[model samples]
Target chain A: MKAKKSGGNSLFSVTAILLILLVWQIVCSAGLVSPYLLPSPVDVVKAFISDLPLLIQNARITLIEAFVGLGLGIVIGFVFAMMMDRFEPLYKAFYPLIVLTQTIPTVAIAPLLVLWFGYEMTPKVLLIILATFFPIAVSMLDGFRSADRDTIRLLESMGASGWQIFRHVKFPGALPQFFASLRISVSYAIVTAVVAEWLGGFGGLGVYMTRVRKSFSFDKMFAVIFLISALSLLLMKLVEVIQKACMPWTKTQ
Target chain B: MADLSIRDVSFSYGETQILKDVSLHLKDQELVSLLGESGGGKTTLFHVIAGVLRPDRGQVLLNGQDITGESGHVSYMLQKDLLLPYRTIIDNVCLPLLLAGMKKKEARAKAAPNFADFGLAGTELQYPHQLSGGMRQRAALLRTYMFSLSREGSPVAALLDEPFSALDTLTRQEMHRWYLGMMEKIRLSTLFITHDIDEAILLSDRICLLTGRPGTISEEIVIERPKSKRDGFAVTEEFLEYKKRILKGLKRT
Candidate 1:
């Protein structure tokens, strides 16, 4: 049943993509643009299939970087939210720092990280972490801080200790927001890993693109691009599933 | 008898005084409902009495012992039910017990008996959102009363501030009746704050009427045989007479 459902979904998306391809192919055939700049859908799919194994390999590398960085980013974000909750001065001082970090683009910082850590996984992971941290921190902070004030007051009246209030009220309230942030951050985490890999790397989809470009294999490049998109969609769907699982109350009736 | 007394209590936000030389007392297991309009400082007084806020000047005496600025001695119910939406009803109720260093298993076991008293037995595993307003209020009350600083004993007192304001008229009346029944069954002192004079009279052994933007007790009236009071009978001549007096006191401001 699950496979049937997923196959039906894939068919729907595939149909939608074929329609877009039809439009693109018509536009290109009408000499709207050169083939070099906008490859036809057939050429792209042909390129993609031939280089599937290589694309898959690079994707594995990018996925590792993204997932690892995401784990670190989530941990850091949660701890930062906790610190902000524990002390007012810390919240005031650190909130601005978080915003500052987000403004400094990971693309801008990627090269610097490569220089510092060399052309290793460290730079890619660092870039991904930097890119993904802010949303989770900001969302979780706001969620944790705004946790039903009335509930906290009621808990206080119930003789709840500070830690008890956090454990029972604030922490639970922050989950939905945290999951939302995780969803956003996951995409950013993957894209960041790809971007960092592009700067200079031996492996990852970035490197695969580089190889395809050098050989002028437009089809394989398009295939790699398709795979990357698929990967992102998969990650996003996973996060959505996790979110629903964690917050069972939010499931639609 | 556990009585609470506020002696010459005073408070100010910067130079603007809230309460000045105010005094009120509630005998053991007595319920005193406070009647006032918005910005009347009734809530501030309630906060001070509950030890959530410190009075600029005064002594909050529990059983004639100074507990001013102390914590965890009184239970409070704010305007909303403030149940942790993520937690099961039983977990929310067991919060105070866990805070007071009770083992989770033991605290939960302790809360089991009072679950049915508040008419929240089978719904213990339900999230707060699943329960109706009246049900949530009952669960909140049960949570408050099931845990005390004395390590999971019954609550000493409850401070209810417009706790039924969000409920419909019928539910509000039902909750008021339930509240009275709950208090009598538990024999806990209660300080109820409400802008509705009828509600104040309905739940209180005595009603203290306050006036002023920076409030003060402008009038006080005692309702004898309060435990035997009828619900939805606020339109009775006796109830109407008290409400009229409170309105008059309020108009003087």
Candidate 2:
């Protein structure tokens, strides 16, 4: 029953999207909107097909930067969360700082990162890490802190060591939240990489979008925008797949 | 077999005293229930006995050894089953053994045989969410039993804090039956915490009434019946008498 309900919802979502596309195509065909400003769905599709090879090449670069940055972000975030959870003093001192990092806009940070690390892949990766790590760290820390006190006491009663308590209880308890944050961080990683690339980069989807915008080829720019959305959605889906694998018990529920 | 004793234990959370001069004992293979109202420090006493909290005064002893302010001497079970969502039933039950430094393969081998005894034979490969409420409680009980196993293979005492309180009435009654049967077979000394008068009378060899602002054992009542004879005991005149006495004692407090 639940699965069927979700399936119906997805069908409605697809239909809604298609209806909007049809209206867009009609408006562009009637010359009500300039193609340069608002390309029709058909024109965007055509542009996507024509620029497929170049898009793939640039996407590969962006994906590499995103993946590398996201991986590093996860490691750093895990460490930060562990430290915060294990030590009260550290948690008190660093929790606000961690939250502060999220207040700064990614766009604002991208330029500074580019200036510091130059137009190379370094700046793009750094920007992605900066954007990605906050959610992972914060969510994981919350997860750890939210572990049931009774359960912790239960383990402690069994002569479990500090490390044992962490391994058997805290780590597993944090996984669901970790995956939740990873979904957010994954999209942040890709978007941040692209944003960083826009400022300066040898090659990436962002750099390509910048070039297309300068040439006034809005159709190509629309295609890149759609592609980025698709990529972010794909990464989020991958996170869900991994979450299922890691937490099979959730599936049974 | 092992016995547990909490002697003159007093605990406070800063200025707020939770327990005052709380002392209790569980003989080998005996079941003792701590009966009280909410905020009566039943849980605080359990925490002290479990060694998760240090008493401002007095000692917690297991088998005549002082275990005050120390953990890992007794097995503790909480209201929630607290099965790790990411692990299989076998793995979850084997947690204590793993924490004790046993190899994973060896721990699994040891725990596998007892799954049948615990009425969890086929659930070895399943996760906690796949089980019913009653089944999950049984698994948690089995895990608690596993935690109580000494290096030499003797079972220690267990501290259970409202282990079946969350279940529905039917399941709770069923759990009561199952618990009595398991206790007969294993002969584990247990200190159970609960506010339910009928449950205290049904399961305990002795019931300790904990009451007042700074909680202390206000009274102790002994039930005169063999374990096997206690089936359907809730409807008996003797059960009613005990319940009336307990209710009067609680009301007095």
Candidate 3:
């Protein structure tokens, strides 16, 4: 019954999106906004088809950076979370600083990263890592903290050591939350990679967007926007699939 | 000597006494229930016995060894199934062995044969979410059994904390029957905690009634029915006699 309700809601969402698209096309065709400023749906579609090869090539660079950054972010998050969880003093001292890191706009750091690492893949990857790791680390820390007290007690009764408690109880308990944060971080990775590339990069979708915008190719710019949306959605879906595959017990629960 | 004994164990959190001079014992292959009201220190006693919490006074003994504040002497199952959602059912069951420094293949091999005994055969590779509530509990019980098995010497005793309270009424009844049957074969010295009087009567060879603000066992009532005659025993005069005595005991608290 609940599943059917959610299914209906999603169908309604799809219709709402299609309706918005139709309204957008109508307004563009009616010349409510200048074609240069807001391309029609048809024009955007045509531009997408024409620029497909270039877009795919540039997107590949951005995607690679995103993946590398995501991997690095996960490792950093896992280690940092473990450290914070293991040491109360570390957690108390660093928790506020960790939250503070998220307050600064990631875009503000892009230029500094570019200056230090140059217009190479390194800066873009680092920017993405900086952008995405916060969610992973915070969520994982929360997960570790929120492990069921009863289960931990169970492990302790079995004569489990501190390390054994973590292996058998804390780590597994934190996984669902870790996967939830992964979905957010995966999407953040792609967006941060693009934002970083825009500040400075040799080749990527963001660099391509800057070039197209300078030439007043709004349709191509819109196409890149749509492609980025698609890519983010795709990455989020991939994470969901992997989470389901790995945590099958979550499905029944 | 009893397989497990708690000699005048008392515990407190700062000023609040959770358990006061609580002494209890379980002989070899015996199953006993600790019956009490909510917040009556049943769990505190479990924690103390499990060595997750050190008592303010007294000792926790396994096979006459004073193991107060030491862990891994007994297996414990919490109220929730507490299955690690990320691992396959078999892997969850094999966790204790893994924690004991057994190799994955060897641990899995040991856990494999008992799936049939636990009535969870063919779910070896399945995730926790794929199983029903009763099945999840079965898997948890299997995990608890494995934790005890991994230890050397006498059969591993189990400490279960209201292991069926989450289940629906019908499922709870069904599990009671299944659990009693399994106990006959496995024969682990067991300490079962429950607020449910019927449940305590149904599963325990003896029910230890815990009462008062800082709880201790007020009375111990033995159930004499053989395993074969336990079915439909709940409606019998003998069952009501025990229930009336227990209710009177609770009133005294």
Candidate 4:
């Protein structure tokens, strides 16, 4: 049942993408903007194919940074959330600061991180972790708090210890929210990885885009933009797939 | 197997007294119902008995042990099934045993034998969402039973707070019949809380009446029908008499 609905959704998404690309191509062909400034789909495709090897190399670096950052972010976020949940005083102290972290523009902090951690993967990964962990942590904390009160009571009556309550109830209860945040964080990881690279990086898609932009290679710039969007979409899809596999019960009703 | 006694328990939330001098006891192999109006502290009493809440006065005793302000002595089932959404039926049922320090494989094996008795034989691998409401309740009850049974390697009392309240009328009726059979088979000293007088009459051996602003047990109506003769007893004259007496008791409050 769910398969059919998702299939129809994909078809609609494909049609929408095609419609958007067709309109973009028409605008480019109509000379509404200079070809140098607004490359056609064909020009972007050609650029992509010609620069495939370099793009692949750069993409590999960015993906590594993103995945590492995503893993670290999830761990850190979960630990922070668990601490806040387990201790009321910690929750009172840390919750406001957690919210505050998101208020400072990530872009504004990118340069500082680059300066602190140098032009290496460390800064990029750290930036990705910062960008992605907030939503994951906050959502997880909410899920933990909103766990059915009765179930906790039930477990308590069973003589379950604190750890048992966490394992048997709180963690599993928080899973749906964790997965929900993961979708956002997966995209966030990639975006932050690239943004961090934009500040300073030896090699990555962001660096390649920077290099291409400096040379006035508009078609290649379009290629990189398309590549970044495609990567983000792919990562989001991967998270969805993992979510379905891990939470098969959700598909049933 | 052990008896449960709630002795002169009084509880208040801040200035609002919920229960005043509430006392009740569960005989071994008996099913007792605490019938009360909504917001009349039935759940609060259950929480106190289940060790989720501490009574402002008095104590809860399991067998001869004073278990006040301590949890994991009685198994509890709430209005909602409260099944873990991500777990399969078997895994959900295995939770109590798992929490009791049984190995995973051993716990799974232990829980496997009771699936047929619970009328959940074919759904061992299915998730909670895949089951009907009645089926989920059965699973929850079975989990509750397992939780109580394994807590100290003996049969323990269960506190059920409107376990069948979420079902449709027909399903609820059907569940009551199934529950009576299951109760007999498991034979855990049970305290069921319900506002439904008919349900109380249909399932419980004795019905304790709780009512009014400061909820207390105003009366206890004992059903004299033996377990073997209880089939279709809900429509019998004796059942109606018991129901009438309960209505009068509730009215007095």
The candidate scoring highest on DockQ is 4
**How high a TM-score does candidate 3 get?**
0.85
RMSD of each: 3.8, 2.8, 3.6, 2.4
lDDT of 1 by residue, A1-253 (tens): 8779999999999999889989988987888988877788877877777767877788889999999999999999889989998899999999999999988977888889999998889999888878887888899899888887666776676667788788878887889899888988888888888888888998999887888789887667777778887888899899999888888767523
Docking class of 2: medium
Show where candidate 1 strays beyond 4 Å: A1-15, A24-43, B148-155, B211-214, B229-253
Models sorted by lDDT, best on top: 4, 2, 3, 1
Task: Choose 2 or 4, whichever is better by TM-score.
Answer: 4
DockQ of each: 0.49, 0.69, 0.56, 0.77
Q: What is the lDDT of residue B131 in candidate 2?
A: 92
DockQ of 1: 0.49
lDDT of 2 by residue, B1-253 (tens): 5878888989999999999888888899999999999888988888777777889999988889898988878888888998877789999999888988999999999889989889998999998888998999999998888887644455578889999999999999989988899899988899999988888899999999998889889999999988888988989998899989999999996
Candidates' TM-scores?
0.87, 0.90, 0.85, 0.92
Off by over 4 Å in 3: A1-42, A49-52, A250-253, B36-38, B121-134, B165-175, B195-207, B218-253
- What candidate 2 gets wrong by more than 4 Å, as runs, is A34-38, B12-23, B36-38, B150-155, B209-222, B232-253
- Model 1's CAPRI class? acceptable
Q: Which tens-of-lDDT digit does each residue in B1-253 have in candidate 1?
A: 5677888889998988988877888877888888888887988898888887889887998766788887677888766777766678888888777777789888788888888888887987888888988899888777667654343333366677888898899998888788778777787778888998778777888888877766777788887655766755677888788777878888988
Measured as a fraction from 0 to 1, the native contacts recovered by model 3 come to 0.86
The better candidate by lDDT, 1 or 4, is 4
| Root-mean-square deviation of candidate 1 | 3.8
